[model samples]
Target: AQTVTQSQPEMSVQEAETVTLSCTYDTSENNYYLFWYKQPPSRQMILVIRQEAYKQQNATENRFSVNFQKAAKSFSLKISDSQLGDTAMYFCAFMDLSGTYKYIFGTGTRLKVLA
Candidate 1:
């Protein structure tokens, strides 16, 4: 079984700054995908970034980026120029692409970006 871990239960950042949220996972399978999901107060899980195990280059989307260390089994999300709207509960998720596509998610990190 695979599991994801987020050491930080909660984190805060000032608007217009950068914040990195940490995530680590344990998996025996070699083929899989890692993801960072953001859930705002509205309760919708949005895909923030994704990384394929085979990809050497990390995944990035605008202000969102991920540091994917395959050997270390570490995937962290870096949010640049944080905004008040960026405040949300971030979850690190894992999906085994070869299997039934079940998603295993971390406990979650509640991030608050203050103005």
Candidate 2:
């Protein structure tokens, strides 16, 4: 069974600054996928970014990026040029391609971007 862990229960960043949230996982399979989802106060799960295990290069989307360490089973999210709108609950998740697409998520990391 693969499990995702976000060690930081909460984090805060100043506007225009950058913050990185840590995440780790335990998995036996060499092939799988990792994702980061953000849920604002509205509670809608939004995909932040995704990384394929086979891809050595990390993934980035606008202000979001991921640090993926395959051997360590660690995947972290970095939010650059943070804004007030970035405040939300961030969750790390994983999926095993051989099995169901259902994602196993972390408890969550609440990010507060202050102006």
Candidate 3:
């Protein structure tokens, strides 16, 4: 069984501050992909960052970075210099090549960028 967990159902940070959202997963497979998605009021899912299970280094994009611990099965997203536009619902996702070409998403963490 594969599952993702976002313990924080809601989070808030001041504008221009940094915030980290935690995500823990449980999986028996070795090869997999972990991702963080952001969905705002537009209701569109945007990929924030992605990490491969085989990669030793974490994956980062612009102001977003991931702390991926393969051994602990944890993947957390760090948002630096958060802006008003960064306010969104963040979802931790997992995918693998087990013939199930679909993504498993966590309950989600609603992040608010307080001005």
Model 2, 1-115: lDDT tens digits are: 7788888998999999999999999999888899999999999999999999999999999999999999888899999999999999999999989867878999999999998
Model 3 residue 114 CA deviation in Å: 0.8
Winner on lDDT (2 vs 3)? 3
Best candidate (score: TM-score): 1
Query: Model 3 — TM-score against the truth?
Result: 0.97
RMSD to the hidden true structure, all candidates: 0.6, 0.7, 0.7
Which whole-number lDDT from 0 to 100 does residue 5 have in model 2?
Answer: 86
Candidates' TM-scores? 0.98, 0.97, 0.97
Model 3, range 1-115, lDDT digits (tens) per residue? 7899999999999999999999999999999899999999999999999998999999989999999999999999999999999999999999987887679999999999999
> Alpha-carbon error at 92 in model 1, in Å?
0.2
Per-candidate Cα lDDT values, in order, are 0.97, 0.94, 0.95
Q: Given candidate 2, what's the lDDT at residue 34?
A: 96
Model 2 CA deviation exceeding 4 Å by range: none
Clashing pairs in 2: none
